[model samples]
Target: MRKIDLLFAEYGESHQNPTNKFIHWICVPLIFWFILGFISLIPSAHVAVLYYGLISVVSIAAIAVVSLYYLKLS
Candidate 1:
């Protein structure tokens, strides 16, 4: 089988437990929000060309990268 197929099979097995899946539904968003809150606490800095502060730039980059990854998988 191809690499992507193998990866999906493995991921499927890992998430088969209902309790584990439930915890993932809750914890994943909580952790993501926690990380973003922490990032927001960091002192903001001005970027010369972008005009956006550091946190905004980092958040946008992260969202773009994750979106691209999901698009590729789908």
Candidate 2:
């Protein structure tokens, strides 16, 4: 919808700024890590350790890339 698109455009414009974007980049991965860690703690889950490890690695890599992006942007 046009309204949704307009809202997204406004949000995107704010996020396009270097500092706010960098903060989101850092926080998003950290939030994912916490969510994955929480899920891994569930008793009935299979492959919990593997999932935790994979998510951890992904989060680290995402943080690294975000840091590089921030540096370049700044």
Candidate 3:
């Protein structure tokens, strides 16, 4: 978990560059949406589509804000 967190921190640092940040802003949510959509195809997870959708939106928003904040700081 610690390693994963460190990796993400490094990734966030790289994304402070405007081009990389823009790419991430677009790709991240799309990747997450596809992931959730794939998971929702599972029988058990299908029932929780709304929950997953909300979480995905919130996560994307949070990431966007954080990325922008870091970009501004850098």
Q: What is the TM-score of each candidate against the true structure?
A: 0.63, 0.50, 0.48
Query: Which regions of candidate 1 are displaced past 4 Å?
Result: 38-55
Cα lDDT over the full model 3: 0.65
lDDT of all predictions: 0.75, 0.66, 0.65
In the order shown, the candidates' Cα RMSDs to the true structure are: 4.9, 9.5, 9.1
Q: Rate residue 24 of model 3 by lDDT.
A: 82
**Number of backbone collisions per candidate, in order?**
0, 0, 0
What lDDT tens digits, residue by residue, belong to model 3 across residues 6-63?
8889887877889888888899889877765665444441122554442344444545
If the candidates were sorted by their lDDT against the true structure, best first, what order would they fall in? 1, 2, 3
Provide the lDDT at 27 for model 2: 99
User: How well does candidate 1 match the true structure in TM-score terms?
Assistant: 0.63
Cα lDDT tens digits for candidate 2, 1-74: 67666887898987877998899989998986776666545545232355354234444455577679778654
In angstroms, give how far residue 14 of model 2 lies from its true place: 2.2
Instruction: Order the numbered candidates by TM-score, best leading.
Output: 1, 2, 3
Best by lDDT: 1
